[model samples]
Target: MINLNEVLKTLNDDKQQEFINYLDKKNKRKDAKNIQLVKLLLIDKYSSQEISEKIYGKQNKVALHALRKRLFQSLIDFTANTCIKEENSLDVKLIKYIIAARSFLQKEQIEVGYQILDKAKIIATEYQLFSILNEIYHTKIQYVHQYKTLNLEETICNFKENQQQLIQEDNLNIAYANIRKSLNEYQQKKTIIDIKKLIENTLKTQNISDLSLLSFKSLYQLLQITTISSSQKFDYYNLTSFATETYKIVENHTSKNKQLYYHIEILYLISNIFFRNKKFHQSLKYLQLMNFYMNENKQKYLKDFSSKHDLLLALNYNYIEKQEEAIQLLENSINKKSSNVIQNLDIYLTLIVCYFQHKNLTKAQNLLSKLYHTDKWYLEKAGLVWTIKKNLIDILLQIDSGHINLVESRLKSFKRNYFKHLKDIHQENVIAYLKLVEIYYKNPEKASSKEFYNRVETSFNFIDNKKEDIFMMSFFAWLKAKMTKQDVYLVTLELINS
Candidate 1:
């Protein structure tokens, strides 16, 4: 519905006039009623019923329905024609000429057909669209057979040469696409074992050395390997090391200004890796480099990048005990209009965490309410992070508000909806943390005692081997603070630094 409004809003005066002309020609008369109906419907708020009644009268229900259908078809046709006129690319023009040539051929307009074919051939050659060029050759051969034109030996040779080049290019493009597709799969699920298998199978079939000739694809594959390998092994030292080396490779090999976006992406990924590994200063450095590259390139439409960058920066701020700065950045970063934001769920979840950490229960509750009621909170089905974090935050909000009954109710719903899926120990830990809270709420003295801290420590023994579990990291820090009688923010920072 929003998309319909946007398309309608894009209808400029010229397009509207064109649509009017189209309707006039179709009707074969200066029918003012349909035109007026169209103009009324084009407005933001006007609807079918309003336009219908105005056109056919409220008594004529059947006629009004027919008129409304006509209006809808007219709008669709107008939009399509407008888009067709706006598409002025060389390939599109070439295809259009080919289509026109075929139409003329059907009418036995030989000269006009050849003229259109000539234009198409020129375009195909200029754009190196050899696939289309092959078609043009066959088409011209048809023209020759029909008209018995001059023998075209040279054109046949040209076709043969183009065919070989086209084959090689297609093969390389397919290989690149396969690698990119596998990389995309890894990114979506972040399962290193699956990606490793995919990559191994791809390597067995394709020459990795040849990939260097395909520079961008090569760089992307190398970057993916570096991150995925490090993540699979949980090796932060080499992750940071590989990230630095990859940054240099990008700077030295890729075109600076043209590949600015990819370069910034590499830096952002590296920074996030560092951030995940508790290397705040290193993460901050890479983030600074990302900003420097963007500044140097003077990139446009950075709202999406800005949103993610702010979220990361806010996270670093919160980790280093700059709660005010973190909260402010999080507050500023919420509900951005950028459709390309990569970490919207993370941003929202982080902001709520920051608010809760600050003990601002009212603001946290308000934000949670907004997120809960907002339609389609989880936009994709790739990860449990969004679901887990969302559930954790809701539980945290209720616990902070001292609403034991509401907390229990939310927990019941959470367990029912998500229990079967929570097979992993890390996932189960979230429920454990919530249950700990419930227990504490029931018996406040035990929560405030040293024995409570020991019990908390003993309870988290299962997480002992889980090094830097990103989802459970903050909760573990909060648990430590509860036991140590320290500030949660300070304890979180200490845990991160440690």
Candidate 2:
């Protein structure tokens, strides 16, 4: 008979080694059925997902959540089930072991802890406490101590030294800098071919195409630079073309790399450009693409992120006048998150405004009450943008535009105050409102009393709206209706010729 073992071992040594390593890692996982009380007691001690995974073997997030919930729900049951606590009895021996272990760990004395464990193991295999202590000493303590001393000042000093050490030969950072400057200059005057060429050549030389794993750190820095530079100089066509070209290349050749954030940045750029170009569908398309990758990334990685994408999604939908859709998206974003108050506050404020716009003042007031308790939410509520939003909501739902007398009485401040903070992006819609003021000053008859019947005509040419003329006509009619007692519907203007 043939030896089965020999027959099965015919694979090459390289493949065999790889398989062995994989099995070793797989074997280290905790049993799915394994329920340990001690592990739960020490749960708070095991910080970070990666360390928890390493210590527990294979763990699902659901299990961790369930474990915590069970502990809180029934503390006595939690104390009873753990074998480590039962034998050790939380007695002086166990307490002494824990204290010594904690001390050894704090002092980075891993060898001392390991030696203690070995001696304890000789006394009895029942010393499971030693195993936990040893894991803590080796992984947590050793890992933490490898960085530096425990003081903040010393840590800062160490950080600066490390930073200086890394500053050498960062040619990628230099190239990223040049690429951004070129992009900005190109937008301002519509040409930066030579700089673009340099960027293209750098990519070629670095072989940053096809199978080469891209650098996420570099990508984030480059994206940030692009955003800052773009703000300094706005370029519509050239920026869009450049972004589109880059997207095609990256999407086809090297999308598998750590690219979720970069993809989001690219989509944002495209959507903003499309918005400026009066292409609502196109803008929504790019924004949806951004949502797609963001969701994908959230599924794949345990990123250190707060759930703030809801705010962005809501804002985009609101810009396109999809109020209900925006509110739903915000609700979904905040439903399950455990913390990140600042981000949640942002979501809440935006959601409240959306609801207010739809004439749901009761719901908006409820959110405002919740915000009163949340400190960060207060700043956002008292900010300049919130004031404009409040008035817009009042007009959209409660106030009439046709009664010019009524509108003048109600919106007297808005009509007369002349808001001056037009330099901020947060004032985008507000700036459009300011433009209406200027347009009305030159042509007062164009400013209608009925907001619904009165359409937003040629007040601002920059807003992205596919139904531009109709909206302008209807809004002006609506404004006129709100202003004057009679209907004042106007004719729609055709699209501006390119």
Candidate 3:
């Protein structure tokens, strides 16, 4: 019952109704109870035992199990059929072409079979569908002698070439998996690793230059890995160049109509990287391209990318002093229900930051309190980085609201929870920042003193302002504002511009 309900939740209302209609057509008996069970599950108004009683006049696990199984299988069939109808999928088209060619060959229709196979080979090669191309090459090699017009040597050479590519892609996937695993461990357990070095070594070993040969999906994954590494290092200057070059390769090689999803994703990624590097104008340019592509195919993926698009746009607007626009964008998105839990939490946190910058302490406090989930839940859903930001913001909010007791308790709790992890990850600066905040909290008057200002300067091992992360700078700006008695937003803008 739990598994079936989970699967059903993935479908929209229209698809759910289609699945019900499909079950009706497949039902041979007028007395079938599968539909009844699905309807009960859809409404979500009953426990398993209660549902069993409603459907069978009493709790009957055996019959309930059978009905659930039938419905689940029907859903699988319906989903597969629906996917086959997605004509934009190059892989599906290649599969269909290969199947047709095989059938024609089995019936001894030599010319038609060869023609279909040739067409499949062209597309499979164009898209770099190595595995599918391998199958096509295999069929041609098997029937090369039967069809004398076929070049056996050429078929074998293509097969070997595709085999090498398959091996290379497999190796790249393994490297990606290993890098992600290391990143997860670092994020979760605080296992120290140099993310930049790891990525560089992996790419060097893979010989991953000439991005044109990679498929859109492969390039997207590689870009994602690079993004993660750049994020950790707070250095997007090089990633900006790499991502832009990669996007150009994708743009020149792939058809936007067929690969619109990846196209939009790559554009968003480029925009985000540019934003992180504080190249606001360039970021907006890429975002415009992303928006234009999102409207393709009648806005098929608009809903999926809307939250992310608005979030990045708002971030840029906020940094560029368009606070009202940024705040409005975030406020509009905060209440919308999105399947992306991390993204939703980000929207909430960003809004809270905006309110805090505007010195609306009450609103910021209210928003922070609304994040009512447990720390474990947040860590699992949004990862340790987000959880840390939320904790830090909560402390800052309490500090500003003069909730001295709450601030003291939260500061102590944060240290107890994260001090060791931060140290392990070489983020001692965060711990140092918290110490400075605690210093100010305990003696607010001393924050403006030369001795305390020097203490702030000595506490941080400052990097180049251009290479510093924007979020870190924002937090530093808050301390600077306290020392100078200026508006935190103004200080933040100054630090970002610096």
Q: What is the lDDT of every predicted structure here?
A: 0.65, 0.47, 0.86
Q: Is candidate 1 or candidate 3 better by lDDT?
A: 3
How would you order the candidates by TM-score, starting with the best?
3, 1, 2
lDDT tens readout by residue for model 3, 263-336:
88888899988888888999999999888988888787887889999999999999999999999999988766
Best by TM-score: 3
Clashes of each: 0, 41, 0
* Best by the lDDT measure: 3
**Candidate 1, residue 327: how far the Cα is off, in Å:** 2.6
lDDT preference between candidates 2 and 3, better one: 3
Q: For candidate 3, give the lDDT of residue 309.
A: 93
lDDT digits (tens) for residues 10-128 of candidate 2:
32344334433433453445553223432332343544364347545666677655644543334333334433543244334544664575577568786565455345433322322
Candidate 2 segments whose C-alpha is farther than 4 A from its true place: 1-216, 228-239, 252-255, 259-298, 302-323, 337-342, 368-498
lDDT of 1 by residue, 1-498 (tens): 224434544454566688778888888555546777666666757565665667766656677556656756877987766556643345577888888888887788877888888888876665456678887777777767565563578767877877765664565556556655554443344332344455556555554443323334345545665565455434455466767766666666535444555667777888888887777788999888877776653454254378778888888888777889988887777644333333656776787888888878888888777665421335243234455568767876786688888977877877776655453322455566766776776676577787777667666545332246444567766666666778776776666666
lDDT of 1: 0.65
The worst-scoring run of ten residues by lDDT in candidate 3 lies at 251-260
Output the lDDT of residue 122, model 2.
38
1 or 2, which is superior by TM-score?
A: 1
Q: How much is 107 displaced in model 2, in angstroms? A: 28
